[model samples]
Target: IVSDSSVLLCVCISLCLAWLHGDPRKVLHPTDSYGRFCGQKGTPNAKKPILFYFNILKCANPAVLINLQCPTTQMCVLKCPDRFATYTDMQLQHKLSKSYWEYYRQFCKPGFNDPNKGDFHIFRPNLLMCVCVCVCVCVCVCVCVCVCVCVSYRGLLISLVVSLVFILLLRFTARLLLWFTIIAVIFLLAYGMWYCSMELSQLRETPGSDVAIVDVGLHTDLQVYLQLRQTWIIFLVSLGLTEVSILVMLIFLRRRVQVAIALLREASRAMSYIMSTLFYPVVTFFLLAVCISYWAVTAVFLASSNEAVYKHTFLVNTFFSLCQTFNRTNISKTASCLGSQCTFAFYGGETPYHRYLFILQLFNLLVFLWLVNFSLALEQCTLAGAFASYYWAKRKPQDIPPCPLFSSFSRAIRYHTGSLAFGALILSVVQLVRIILEYLDQKLRGSNNMVSRFILCCLKCCFWCLERFIRYMNRNAYIMVAIYGKNFCTSAQEAFFLLMRNVVRVAVLDRVTDFLLFLGKVLIAGGVGIVAFFFFTRKIPVIQEEVPTLNNYWVPLLTVVAGSYLIAHGFFSVYAMCVDTLFLCFCDDLERNDGGSEKPFLMSPELHRILGKSSHSRISPLQILLVWDKCLPSSNSKMLQVRIKEPKTTEEMCHPSNMSVKILSHSGHSISRGNKSNTTTPQVYLLTSHPGSVLRFSKKDLQSTAHLIFQTHVHTKTA
Candidate 1:
């Protein structure tokens, strides 16, 4: 037996070696009994068939390999059968087009050409049957276990159902409240417009003769009064049309609006989740501080270098002007004056100060652009990292630290600085182009020529589209960099590809999320406006006395609205980013995990539960794996030893060290050596080491082993 085993091992080794070093031609084209190649018929004074030669030899003699006809040399000779008149030189030329070494290097190795010789390839068609079997078994087991668990926990199930019902009720109530608010706002605005029109008409109808004469004397133009009345009428008509349009939109696009609202809620929830972390606010403030400092320094540098004359000569005035530009305020009057002075200073003064100022301004602009891009990139990176960390913790079911924001932020600055800078540079260039185009468009609007205006309009539209595309790409790239630690270009390319691959899903998600955010902004701004209006009107007694003096209530209301919008945008932007980061992470998780026991999903349990419910019929493999994992003994238990027993029938074959003995009772089949006991020894199996072998133990067997171990320990203690 030993000799036979040795012979078998030797044969296996020999076969492996032969496969690794064997010639392809010898294996593919064997010689027949007549000592001729299988495909060849006769031998003649011609060249040997090129197909029969090895790759190495064929590469050395390229000319011979290229020519199909037999050579004049005695060693290179061949002849074909009479029926093989369909031979063509084109076949040989095609085969020898590339050197044999190159072809062999690509399609074949030195050894046997067996594609399945490497690691287990899940994509192989042959594995489909096995995968199907495993899937079906897993599904069956999961269903049975789930049913049993549900039956055992009837009270919990009831509570879950009640909670779901309550949630649905709340959602419906919220939607109704939103609709009511919209209607109320519309009606109030309409009433205010009607009142304004009535007052304007009354004023216009009152003649100058009927007016009360003042001590200083007063003059009135009837034409101006009439124009004012006309304006009121037009405003009333526009307001009415707007109300009608809004009503039509509410009726026609109710479903879309609801979806947008739902998406916004989800985005808000995602944002809140991140903000709940302790360090998020700290990180946000740190970034803000950096931006503020950078902005101040940049402004100072530009202001100090200005040699142009200003109405106010102090450098502080120039600094304030720069600040105004940074805030996106319309400082066209101040800017125009500065531009004219600068040109005059450049040509008339022509001093070193003027030249230095020009250089400084250019340098400041570039630095400002860079800093803006960097700040945006930094925020995105930090937020993305925080979201990714949260996702990782949830997916792995691990206890994360109270605040990992600093760690993530530091990593982003250290590892992703280059990527961030690149992204920022691209974004800055796009923004600069957009600004230039907008300026040109504004200038063209003043021109009388229609063609120039039309051209500028087209350019503006194209640039707007381009700017949006670049921004989307840059945002996604930053997220990718945060998650994967890739370079800017690679991350951007990958992000583009990922979006392209899932374009429809991305489009739907983006539209839904954007609408939801837009609605939130409107709600915030409008709510502030309404509150301010009521306070100004003395409807709120608590704050009526504290109201500031304003020329009109509308002025204060509009200011509050704008302020509220800006605040809302700042707060909600973080949430919107969180939503985007989580979404990309989710997409990556779907692609990487196959729902196998070995490859667990990296997503939250809540997300998994939601997915399971939605895809119950076509349950993901990961879900099935999760179910199986739950059924298994907890990996956290260190007291239990897991063993895979080998197949064996003889009791002696099992090692003594590997087995434990225990006493048993005959009547109850319990372990007790002292009284009413009978020895009922359980059979044991040996263990083997084989890659392809799987050892499965019955639940009954495992239970018996546990019982035996317990009894043995007890018997020893008593003795």
Candidate 2:
């Protein structure tokens, strides 16, 4: 039942190799150019956790383009340099004061005592000013604790409550909630436009604020852009366009939105019955975390496999590999001028194993992507199966199976693993190509060849769209696979056609539902963000004392906001899947059954009513006679009076061309025709309402099945 046992085996083998060869320390700790991991315990550089570049400007050397590393001397340091002082300046000051030498020694390599030994003495001012900020252990632990407290109380707790309430609201008041969310989003955007306009108007009156952002160029402090009038204008225009777009969509697709809301209501009902599905995202999150951890560890090990190799660069453009151990005496030989030193170049080797590390890392990436996608596919399939049970059941909760989520999950893991892996593999391949294209784009960013850049950009965009389409197709295919237990390719084909057959509904209903759900997420995130901002900023008077004092409160505020959005998304994702499954099932129901008792619709009665459909298979004889009397002439109606008589057996009465009547038995079987009777007695009974019969008769005469009616004419009463 494992869909692709071979693929699973390959995954296992790849992970095993990765675990055997990978060392995660390379990623967790910074590494010096000397190939030693900084901050690692039980090492010489254990006390020196920070890696420092001797000449930061030399990092801009053209060799960086080829080697992907700065071509400069790097060393481990205990702390960053707080003050800027050139080696030459420090050397002269050292003679006047011992403090200068003590301070300068921290920047020098280990065991270097005499500064006069080197031939090069000149040092650039930029060489020593580059500093890397390092947080102390205590501070880091404190921040971690604070972040945990904030996320647990402000983020997780609120998000969980909000998400549950939102889902429940959707079940009973889906239309109202969806419309409210849509309106709120529009108003929020409108408010943003107004605010931006106000800011722009005020900035126009302020001198020096009229400068264009382009003239100012880029700034490290983003607040500088706010001072420019053009920035606010751009924001106002962007918000205005967004507002208009949403309004236009709402106006044009109002009916479709209503349908989508109805579908959401159905989905909510499904989720209400299968409450276990709301927690399935936790399982998916755990699986994804495992995959990401494995990939990171393997990549680190593969990268660290290369030992430190040093390259000695002379100030005059000559380069040599420092293959042998050398000391200050060797430094003098290389230092014909300033900037000459033995620098750690790149991590690599001539061995066959080291040569293939790139391939191994790529392999690691591919497996990671495959596993991530597989986990998502498995979730989709499991949720689909659970909701599918809800859709197919005739009775609401009584007919639905118990523990549907568990059964569906078991089925997905036991039988559809291979199929899930197959689908994930196809997507993984496309994603890997997109990643490669992105990498190439980044590499070509500095190139003068515009054609190559354009080509890479096109490839990137094409692959992006391709990934989106594939993801959509894969989701629907997994749903089909869950319902029918078909192979990946077969299910994909079937789902594709099913969607194509109802392309209009697919476009209008499904997308509108998604849009509404997205708005819900944005609303939750934005509302929570506002509350967090107030709490973090101590703007809420009641909670001011409870708020922790932090150097930057935005950190925790952003954490809460992002956490809320993710939580909301996870909960709403279940809702979205439910809607999609029900929609697909609804379409299938419409196609396979004609709303007749023989093949009644499996959809809920509410859905049937909303769609103006019924399952009745036939019209009753009494109702038929009433219609006949009304439509026919009065003389014929008086002579041909219909009366009821108890019958011993089911029978059909027909007067060849004049009239035809059939009686259906309790077992849904049609009886043979009886001889044309001259007696005026008539047996009129409802076929569908009879005990032991599941059939229901419609009042309409348009049924494709047998009907009860009388052909009326004046000649019938002449006798």
Candidate 3:
């Protein structure tokens, strides 16, 4: 039951302590044998950055592994030796000229100028070969990352086009396209199972291909396992099971899927009005990126704050003294021997702050989760407010306010920050508990007790479900906060009961919509992945010249595939939020407004048609046809009936500014007449408040009022 303010205070304190005690330089720079940071400003070894090892071959000694430190001297040097020169050769050349000694002395210990003590030392190439190998590997990886990042933009662009097209198709042909997507996925899985079966059959005919996967164990090369028949059999079984499950679900839930598709189409229509909502995910992404960057830096600095531990001269003397006192025979011959020492072994300290550093790291993770969830909550509330405006509007776009997205964003930031933060804090606590449980599970992975493992597994599953339930509840609570401007607890209670009231719809239609959206994302990612695979593998002759060559083509191919999925997910998240918001609004509309004349449903005509709820329930068919009885000339004398409740007063009828109407033709085409000069068909004059009072407008006046309702000839009915 941690409050938002308490969470904020804890985060501030953790960040403050981390910054005050942590030294990022300790993580960045290597340390010398003396434990001083290399290249640190104003330090003794400020000019020398790279750590050099003396007799680097001795690092292979078994004692190095036991002690977790190299068993040789290490020095901070400005640069590696440019050429190979053994100490013996340097010593031989030192008698003739001091130049070789001058150049080679940089690699030796600080005041050890006597060359004869460096007996049997070869100074094997300054250890640059090993350093170069590591540097080359790092450079290659960085280059690959850069190339992948640059190439990923193409996938992102394609995903943008594909997602936009998908949304548009959903708006126009939701049922058809959704059914197509589902069937395509099922067929694709079936094809995969068939392919795996074929591969398994072929492998059965080959010699030595029947080896069990267990016999090969775990090999670094995956091709070894792929060559075995067991791998194909596993793939075949997995695909077969998946295809069967999907087919069964589709068969049983076909009706519910139609309802979900209707909801998706409505969401798409809402998005069509507020296209700006599609780009709001970019703002969420930027905020999340900032939170992630800050958390990563704080974690790194806090982890590097421990004091550097090294093997010092005092420790070496203490060890020798202990040995002399206990062993009692090593002092006489070993008195004049120069004992070896190690450089930095590890990072740790006996200080109380260092001892409690793990607690600080945990605090950091909690704050990160809180901030990330808060960002997500803000996005949800803002989008909910925007779509709620769309749903509640009496008329479609004309009654809808201008810049609804911006207005909703402003409202969310101005008033609901605390509510969002509170919701985020609740979710963050559950997520933190789940993370801790996962960590414990990983730590106890090797334990032999079946009871402990089972208990841990059950705890993990319970917490995982709890986390998911909290997330779902928090999402709906944010929507309620957007609509009602209530506190987190009240909104959450109301949202929970509202959902419980319609649990069947929530379980069936809502989940079906989610599954469809997930399928769309997978299709987009897989389609783009297939295209990228062909291009990268040079399977496409046209793009072979454009593709960049790499040692492993799959690296960039996988990067493109993953990036496309994320981009598609970002786009699809907006649609998901819209659907959820509209569903909640629909439920609220049904519960509160019963489509009576006084409490008409605010949902659109299509929703009413799909859900079979008419807003003109209280006002029966004849009551809506209130007609004026005056007859006009022979050329145009059409009786006009306005589908509105009978007015009690004359002013209410004459000046009906609050009335909303849809004008339509006999053929069901919406019409708004503009000019009298182009009156080839027919025209209806404006009626005054009195039953027989008529007011005729000039052609110019009709043209001016034409912009108000820009359709063709039609009857009038209040929507």
Candidate 4:
């Protein structure tokens, strides 16, 4: 039997060595070392033949194993364990005992799992979410009571008021509430930052372990920390700035906000829309938290033998703590359900410190709830948005093709991008494979060389199949579906071929228009700054501003320059945000025509030549304008367009230096500018530091739309 098994192993190894070069043939050799046989034959006339190493392996206990690692080589042994030898040998090798293999089989993950795993990954805590939204309740309550109130937006006041009228309520002193929330948030964030900084930045700091990936969650439990490190760091930083800026802006614009609010009694529309969009981000993570919320109350639930799972769970509680702190609530119920779905347990046994992990979630929650209000203003702009939406929507609507110069701009962009979708398929697949491998590698322990190798091999094979499959799906969808049973990559692959994403982003963003807005903002801000400096200089008229004496001329100059940059950036950001809102209004519904002219993807260069396609695809300016208009309930009657023609001369077409853009907004209250004559000439373009956003002609021409320009900040809105 041993001799037969040896012979069989030799035959498999030799076949694998001959066949394995890559993974296109993995299916052909599912269990054996098929990878060993992948390669290509060189010229038939070549003198030397290529050689490959074939590792050998054998198992002594056939009755207790289905497969075994070869002693000499890590080749899989086709062994059948004894207890299930009858059943196991009928499947694979007749080497190992079935009992041993069966025992190990229990460790393998179930073939099928929750399909919702990949869909809409929301995090947790229903009660906590409800608590976070209490500010909304206050608004509604104020409205119902006919009080001069801030809580009339978001329907929160209505919900809370009704609840209070019928049920007992708990309240806190305003001073105590503010102080507690602030202290707790800063504390949690500091701890999280410390833990992640300590573990992730230093590779040596990671503990020696069999399991992997912890430097980064609660709901996904493990994977969240692995994937969302960059996003969270950005969010935390942005959150601080946003809260601070909003509060400052509110203080400065309080009377303005109040006046605006007074003008519009029905200021709920903007509040609803803004809140909905803002809430979406939290919903994803919070749902994950709720699933684990049940584990919050009980300490025994988290006991795990697997140190990786244990540590990861600790991180999850930490994350949940942050979230809960932001809102101020306990999320034990959420933890329980997530705990069930996560099924986090050690592979061998349970943890001794299980109880400690459970309480960690509670402590984290307490901290999060306590710190939320001070560091973050959860509802600062609710009233402003409410007024903005209500006032804008109730205003008169007009119709005009207000911007003729921007006509066909989007179609040009679309034509350029849609043509290249096919060529980018390979690159996209490669990128996707890289993402997958990175994910797998991060999830496993860095020290487990064997597991890492196994994972890498599997991923390599997976990626090979995926690449071919993407190609196959793009070319012959039916053939791929007929053979692989389904076609999947065409839509995704098509999006990559052209500069579709870039073109759409730029056009929908009205990036060039935004640049013009930023230029104007900088000009005004710089002028103001110069005036202030001059005023300071005159106060000490003999101070000689340029003389680098006690007054250190460079200090003021540097400060002014830095201050100018900051002001310019701030203004630019505001303008960019408005422009984004405008662009989004245009492309909101034209999903296929979003980036460009709704052209089908072009596969061949011949098609491109015949069609006379542009280098990138773009949707029509009008199309985008319409979508943006729809999204922004405030600017229903207005639209702006900037169009650059494809210049006949190579200098004009190829170099942005010669490119001219025409900016047109409503001459009146409508956008129906289909038959307008030329009142003013096109604007001259100038380059700016922002590579894509070039400046346009003087600010005097766009003074009327100054408010629009001020609100056009992309950076601020995104932040």
Query: Which candidate ranks first by TM-score, i.e. highest?
Result: 2
Error of 4 at 684 (Å): 14
Once superposed on the true structure, which residue ranges of model 1 sit more than 4 Å away at CA? 1-273, 276-363, 394-398, 440-454, 548-555, 605-719
Taking the tens digit of each residue's C-alpha lDDT, what string does model 4 give over 1-719?
01223323433443343233212222232122222222233422122112111211122332112111122211222221122222223224313444444433321122212222432432111211121133356676545444311111212222223222211110223223223333444454455456555444553444542232343323423334444445445545664664465456446754433322221111122222232332322432353354244223221222221132211222233344333221101222355223212222222214443334433433333322222210111111121122222222312112212221122122212231222222233435454555557656665646568966796878778887776655433322211111122222443343233224346444322333433333333343344444444533455466546332322222343344444454344323322332232222222223432221233221111111212212122221111010122243244433333332322221221222222223343342211222222344222222222312223322233333322211221222233
Error (Å) of candidate 4 at residue 548 is: 46
TM-score of each: 0.48, 0.77, 0.71, 0.19
Question: What does candidate 2's lDDT look like per residue over 390-418, in tens digits?
Answer: 98987778989999999999999888888
For model 3, residues 163-204, the per-residue Cα lDDT tens digits are 889888887898898888888788777777888888888888
User: What's the residue-level lDDT of 102 in candidate 4?
Assistant: 45
lDDT per residue for candidate 1 within 1-719, as digits (tens), equals 01223323433443343334323333244322112344444543123442222122223332322111122211111322111111132234335664422322222212223333334311122211222234357797676545533332332333333323322332345455445546665776677588767866686765552333332243333333334455466668887887787677678767656654544343344444445432343455566576566544443433333232223222223453443231111223554333212111111124564445434434444445655667777788888887777666632324444555667688886788777776766666677767667767666667899988888788778878887888888899999988888888888898888888667557766765665555555655655566656766778888766655433344345455665665556555666787688677766776676333344455653343322222212222112100011233444532223343432221212223322333333233554322222344332221222212112223344456533222222122233
* Worst window of 10 by summed lDDT in candidate 3: 615-624
- Return the number of clashes found in candidate 3: 4
lDDT of 2 at 325: 40
- Could you report the Cα RMSD, in angstroms, for every candidate shown? 38.8, 8.8, 12.7, 30.5
lDDT of each candidate versus the true structure: 0.48, 0.72, 0.72, 0.30
